[model samples]
Target: MSEKNRQGKRTARERLAEEREKQKSAEKRRRVLIVGASVVCVLGLAAVIGVVAANVGKDDGSESAGPVVVPSGAKGKDSLAIPVGKESAKSTLTVWEDFRCPACKAFETAYRPVIHELTNSGQLKVDYHLATIIDGNMGGTGSRTAANAAACAQDAGKFTAYHDVLFDNQPEETDDAFAENSKVIELAAKVDGLDTPAFRTCVEKGTHNSWVDKSAAAFRNGGFTGTPTVILDGKNIYQDQTMTPAKLKQLVQEAAKG
Candidate 1:
């Protein structure tokens, strides 16, 4: 073979090797960019979740008297419960719930009427503790916002009606739709004479946000986990897996008999 032909072949091999190395380098850079972008996106989402969880329960440091959703017939003005029936009732029923929780909606649907009947008949008075556990778990402000709106409704003396309506119109657990102020106002209309401008302004300004935070804090401090937590005579009977609304009413009646 001629020397010139051998030289040309060597140069050709060198060029092909250089081209392959260039291609490999480009692919490596592309892979690195893709992985880096994915990691950044994940970190950003996590940061947002943390911020929302922290801010949802923030104390705004206002000394304003909290929402007055307690019924005219209720007792204990200083506590978190909006009482129904006489304070002299034989039984006290405490319920802890998050408006955004599906399980709570199920519990509400099953037990609301029974509870109403008992309260109306003067057999029991209920203490409602609103919680924002779903907000912490799901990483959004929907639960907190909804709780705040309910507090505002409490100021209108429509806590029970607005409370029931909130559960009735509860969005899917994963959705943050309740975080919108308008939605709560819309739900307030379901309660007769509840959608007043004062209620609207209170909800829009998050006037009860701090109170909602306090209530949520009480729930956490109460050492109970999860929503739809029901306590009858200071006992956690709803923890039983088989307990139903009918069973709950019977238990309340039985407790009253004691």
Candidate 2:
């Protein structure tokens, strides 16, 4: 090969290597920039989450620290249960529920008719213990707030109707609509004579917040796993996959016969 051609070839190889090195450097810089941006975004999201968590914690602390005020006609230990039937009924259903819990709403929707029938017929009584587990799990005060409002309804002698209203109008699990007292009071309008000034004051003041908190503590301490912990005559009937509203009515009827 000619010397000039050889020299030209060597120079060309050097230029090619330099070009490849520049491309690699550019790619490395680009990757670093992308990683840095991703980290920044992650940190920003974490900060926002932290703020939200802190705010929720503060709200929970303030609301749950009040004096325990039991609603009128509340029964059971420490007045934690809101009874929804005649005390003389043969079958008693003990229900632990959270208003914001979708499963609890589902249970209420499915069994409401049967329960109302049994209660009205004086064949069965239900002791509803409200819990705020959804608030603890989902990071909001909707569960606690709604439970307080229900307690206020109990004070107004309209618990069952107001309770049904709450379940009927339950928002999405993640939606904290019930955390606002106004929203809760708005729902009370659906129940006859439940939107009085006394009820509104009780709800707005969170009069039963401490009671609801205590009930939630009881639920947690009772070794229960989830909401809608339905117990019929000391049996956790809710765990029975074969259980249905008709089956529940049958069981209650059998208990009444016994």
Candidate 3:
């Protein structure tokens, strides 16, 4: 065959090799984009949240009883105690998660039914420590914005619902991830007793900005270097490659058995 004719066809193995190379390149670019976006989001908005929070002097309507002290189980670890769910369970489960983290989303979805069963039966209470892990993964303010929005829903006792919506309607991580205003409203509307005027006011001026920053500070100060970290009944569990949610639930159950 002529040189040009010979080049016209390739074996299946050769084609497969080419496709694998393309996939590897795509994964590399994706990793870089996620890191760059997260840094920009945190550096820009975290500062803004600090400034806004300082100006409020505690009038932001998110006043908790006092500064949450890390429990003995999660001692020397990074964590926060936000009363998520019904706040009335034999044992409490605290999670530090980024709204935009896919693993976080998966856990949220996977554990929903169990949570409902636990909360309804008064077996478990869950607290979410919202961390901005994705600000470094996705290149935008989506993580920060989503964190603040969660706080806003939290005010109305609707965080669980809003939490689900955020992960459900999540856009691909990019500069545009945080620009969709309508999605915020859609999530907010689902929150029961979420006053439109008050919620709108909070969202408009980003009232919940402080909560996001404060949570991030807690994560850093508490020594957590990653998102989706859990403090179950006071023991910190930094998941390794072998970790699974079933094992986590087993841990929770065992802790509660005591």
Q: Which of the numbered candidates is closest to the native, going by highest TM-score?
A: 2
**Which ranges in model 3 have alpha carbons more than 4 Å from their true place?**
1-80, 85-88, 192-195, 238-258
Please tell me which model should have the higher lDDT, number 1 or number 3: 1
In model 2, residue pairs whose N, Cα or C atoms come closer than 3 Å (at least 3 residues apart or on different chains), thus clashing, are none
TM-score for all models, in order of appearance: 0.69, 0.76, 0.61
lDDT of each: 0.74, 0.82, 0.60
Per-residue lDDT of model 1, residues 112-201, tens digit only: 889999898878888887788777766578887888788777777788888899999999877988999988888888899999999899
lDDT of candidate 2 over 1-258, digit per residue (tens):
999999999999999999999999999999999987654442223343233234232223434666788899998988888999999999999998888877677677778999999999999999999987767767789989999999998888899999999999999888999999999999988888888999889988888988988887787678775767789989988767667788899999998888
Estimate the overall C-alpha local distance difference test score of candidate 1: 0.74
lDDT of 2: 0.82
Query: What does each candidate score in C-alpha RMSD?
Result: 13.6, 13.7, 10.7
For candidate 1, what is the total of clashing residue pairs?
Answer: 1
Best-to-worst order by TM-score is 2, 1, 3
Give lDDT tens digits, candidate 3, residues 175-212. Answer: 44643445676667666676477666666666656656
Model 2: number of backbone collisions? 0
Sort by lDDT, top down from the best: 2, 1, 3
Model 2 is weakest, by summed lDDT over 10 consecutive residues, at 50-59
Better of 2 and 3 by TM-score: 2
